[model samples]
Target: MPTSRELREVKAHFYSLAGFPNVIGCVDGTHIPIQSCGGDEAELFRNRKGYFSINVQVVCDANLLIRDIDARWHGSAHDSTVYHNSFLRARLDNNEIDGHLLGDSAYPCGRYMMTPILNTSTNAERLYNVAQIKTRNTIERTFGVWKRRFPCLSQKLRIKLEHTLAVIIATAVLHNIAIQQNDTVSIDNSPEEDIISAESNMQPLTSEGNHYRRLLLEQYFM
Candidate 1:
């Protein structure tokens, strides 16, 4: 977990590089498949793709260094649901989070959360979505490199939930270390190499959020 001051630095760095104001990080979730436990808990760990797994949520900075990891949730949990109950939500609700975080359509649009407009009403809206998608690809490729480097993690993890959680967190720690050390790994540039997409059934967190989105469209996007 990054300190509030560290997050502010992250936000400033993103603004300087991408012209996106108040962006501390990008958020996403990837399902790590695991072997069946053969109990009622088995169903809870089964994802929509018909596999038992852990829904691993991650927050990453622009340089693809993970800022946080939440692997405690079951695979059946929705990405939005996992995020809503997180420390991030509590911080945002209290205005402790100084800047917003970028996410895909799977996450709801909130005061400190930005998502692309579901339906474009103008060319500016279209362009805004394009840029948002392009900038948010950091999380996607981060997960890609994490899983591809440790192929066993991408496959059915033959371990219990507690052990699985430890493994996931350790891998994330190693990932950040690798990034800091400038470690190199072969990347699969094919779009198909990305993790499975979320079911993007999104809505704004509050009426105020809708108003903010409109202001963004009118000011920066226009």
Candidate 2:
């Protein structure tokens, strides 16, 4: 997990990069395929893409370092569900994390997690979504670079689930190390497959959060 100072630094970098304010990180989940460890768990590990895997939720900073990651959930878990059950969620709600995280429509919009306007109800909202989508691409590119640097992440692992987790976490750590040391990093544009879960449309939006977004629309986006 990123420290408060690191998060604030990242948020400053993000503002400089894309003109989106107070963006500490980008939140997303990617599936990593694993060999079937048969049990009731076997079916649970199978995702909508029809494979046994783990859904790894990653929070990536602007520098492409993974600030935080959790690969404990089954691939069947929705992005929002995985997030809702995460320790990071508690941290976000508790203000342990200093700023908002950018996410796609698959995740909910709130005070600390900023997501796009789903239906584009207005010109301001549409513009906001455009800027939001652009800023949120940081996580997507992070995934691309991560999977490409550690090619094994892009492949189906033959190892057991425990080792699979170790491999994932280890590679992520190595990825961060490589970046901090200014190693020659190659980013592959090859797309990684991710399950796009539906957002909870009926869920009421937080008034403070909604007001915050509206301010962005009127001030920065308009």
Candidate 3:
């Protein structure tokens, strides 16, 4: 496990990247399929498709150093629900996290977290969306690196759910270490990726979510 100070340092360094401020890091959850363990224990890990799996939530900075992670739940749950019940909830509720979080549309728009809408047309929003897309790419890239480096994550894990979290966290810690060494972590990218379509699903925040996001953005932007 990383010391709290080390985690904070990683968080601060990643958020310091250009155009990113007060950012605790980018947060996302990935599905990790697990082998059946049998009995009631088996049902808890079984997902919608009857496949045993766990949802791993990770928060990483601009450099892809994971600062915080939560990986104990089954994959049948929704990402938003996991986040709502996560430690992120406490940090967000107390206004402890500094900058807005980046995530895919699986998460809804809210203060301290931003996701592109399904439709947006204004020029300013367009520009803002562009920057978000660029920054959020770092997390996806990190995931690719993680799956590649630890082939165990690319396929079904034979370990029990409890043990799986430990393995994932250990891998995250090592990933950050490798990044510090200036390792090459690459993900396949199309030559002509369209930023607009990539972010097209972004929607305006609802009154509550929008007001909260604006307040957080203002606090950091200022």
Candidate 4:
């Protein structure tokens, strides 16, 4: 485990290079299945998918370099709830983050975490969503690179859940190094496919509910 000082240094350096002032990083949770391990510890690994796994929470900077991460929770825990229970909550409460972190709708919007819910109908709301999408893409892209580069993350590993977290962190640090070193990186997306994907994922909204959601999001983000 990295000492507190070392961890702090890493986070500071990461945010500095990322050029996002006061940003603690983008936070999200993912489930990683683990093979059967007997006892109460094993119980913590069960997920809503009816699989055994651990919930991994990561905080990455604007540059997509992980500043801090936690992976001790059971897969069954909600991501938002996990954030509340994790050290990240203390960091946010203590004002350790310069600005609120960006997250997906799975997490509720808070002073410490900014999330966008499809609650808008105004032209202004449309603009805000566009802006949010642009910034939020960074985190999604980072996850893509992280998972692709770390094949072990895509498959089951022999290590204990706790030990596996260390491996994950080490991988994140290495990913940062590659990004810092100016390594070749490419992102792929087809405009047509993207449109289709978005259409499939979009939720329908009632006129009144849409208006309210749009107004609420505008007020909150503004």
Cα lDDT, all candidates: 0.79, 0.81, 0.66, 0.61
- TM-score, one value per model: 0.90, 0.90, 0.78, 0.71
Question: Candidate 3 at residue 11, lDDT?
Answer: 52
Q: Relative to the unseen true structure, what is the Cα RMSD of model 3?
A: 5.0
Query: On a 0 to 100 scale, what is the lDDT of residue 176 in model 2?
Result: 92
**Worst ten-residue run, lDDT, model 1?**
191-200
lDDT of 3 by residue, 115-163 (tens): 7544555554555566566667776677777777787876788876568
RMSD of each: 2.0, 2.2, 5.0, 7.2
Better model by TM-score: candidate 2 vs candidate 4: 2
Worst 10 residues of 3 by lDDT: 191-200
lDDT preference between candidates 3 and 4, better one:
3
List model 1 lDDT by residue over 1-222, tens digit each.
Answer: 467768777877776654666677889888888898787778998887778888888999878888888898888888888898888778778887677788987888877778888768899788778767777877877888887767878788998767988899889889889889999676765543325565446555567667777777777777
Error of 4 at 149 (Å): 1.2
Worst 10 residues of 2 by lDDT: 195-204
For 102-177, candidate 4 gives per-residue lDDT tens digits of 6666665566665555756567566556655555556666766777677677567678655877887788889889
Q: What is the lDDT of residue 120 in candidate 4?
A: 65
